[model samples]
Target: MARPTTLLACCKLYISESRNDAALRAIEQAARGGGGGAVVVNRFTDDAYNRVGYTLVAPLTPSPAPPPLRHAVLGMVRAALEAIDFGAHAGTHPRLGAVDHICFHPLAHASLRHVADLAGAVAADIGDELQVPTFLYGAAHREGRTLASIRRQLGYFKPNSSGDQWRGAPETDALPVAPDAGPERPPRSKGVVVVGATSWVDNYNVPVHTGDVEAARRIARAVSERGGGLPSVQAMGLAHGGGVVEVACNLLDPARVGAEQVQGMVERLAAGEGLSVGKGYFTDFSQDKIVDLYFRSAANTEG
Candidate 1:
């Protein structure tokens, strides 16, 4: 809906999964109306749907009183082998569910117990729905459910990773055997990893051209904070060891110089020099999502 059905008097923040054209405007208007903006996902399309994963946003809505209310988040990530099995079997985005290795970050003020509670709820539900056993990791753990340990117990294999080579072994030892689902039958689901909130950060690197001080300075100046370039962008020029120059920048807002846009800029800057641009982007938005404008204007009253 163009106009929100409910108008909150106090500032508010919430995540919307679907693609919304007015999200940016909505955030701005809401903030102006006393509601703060949220950590929203920005997406781009590649001629198809490439649903990678979701991002965790902290502190949805700021509390009116003193300190802001800590954002209570709940999410479930797929196991590596399990995700690969589904993806390859499903032929979705290249699998290997381990997007990045397990690195549990402790929430600022919460405990593993709290996260375990959420995971427990999800596991129980998955157990019922998929008729699959579940494992719980960290503090809010179950009697037999433990992460990484659970996979180790299950003898999870990455057939695709090793070219159909069975790398792990089934739990021949019953103690290490995976627990059952609701009924405790054959294990189906690769246990869940309950995550706790923490201070999250977004960082990236954009490789630059040869070590031409002037050219490097030009690109950096054209793409930095003090240059009125990208908003919240912090950039610097560094000299590479082999007499080549690089442009280092912190793109606080990818919305300004999106991945494609950044690549183009670098290419244009380095053109006629037979150089190439390599870039990286870390964001919480959808991959197929394309930012576009949707304007609704009232006809000229006088006309």
Candidate 2:
């Protein structure tokens, strides 16, 4: 049998875990068994954040309408919930659920509308089957809400427990804003999840050789568009454990303003602070590399 010539899309799912290799393995196994035509091209795990990010690619056309990306994401979320307890979860990165965030991006010939549809389906699956509150943003939202907007409404940027860390469950029985899907009250052990679909985004991190997270935050603010700096960039300074802090950035428009620009700005800002800066790194493969890996994985599967 020959596979159909189809458009491709990518889904980046962030689950809460860096330790417990057994649990992470089980989650990946469950995702693979979910029967999605999707292939996970990359898995990035951050120890300080205690998070695992999976990059999955799938055909947007052919093989059962809507594909099985929803099944795969749902399977991962379910496995994560089973393995992780939000009440005991603590990390430098801010998050809400065992499955922290899931975002879909159109790739190659895939359309944003189609990817948004897939995102909505996955959100519905988690909301209906698992009975979890799922919030929608980006193209999946009716009003085209941004993920940052939803995060702000949910107090995602603020640390709930320590001065610099988020520990235990989110401090709300009932959500401040009604969820786009699922119940009003979140289940204690498995907080709420945010889902969305958007254009390709670049994840870049510039490390500063300093433990002062606040200084890092100042540099991050100055580098972000929100603080009268780079256009089409969103940034946050986070402590990555050790004596290092990172200005984690999401380049919304990498084509116009790439990682090099962000890196230079960080370097200049850190120099002023008397902090040495390390070369930044991307958290995932490039678009061309991702496409190559997807096709290779598909061929291996078909063979």
- Best of the candidates, lDDT: 2
lDDT of 1 at 187: 32
TM-score for each prediction?
A: 0.32, 0.96
RMSD of each: 14.8, 1.6
What is candidate 2's lDDT per residue for 29-96, written digit by digit as tens? 98789775878999999989998899998877665765767777778889988888888889999998
Q: Which regions of candidate 1 deviate over 4 angstroms?
A: 1-51, 56-108, 142-147, 160-176, 183-303
TM-score of 1: 0.32
Clashes of each: 13, 0
In model 2, what is the error at residue 3, expressed in angstroms?
Answer: 10
RMSD of 1: 14.8
lDDT of each: 0.35, 0.90
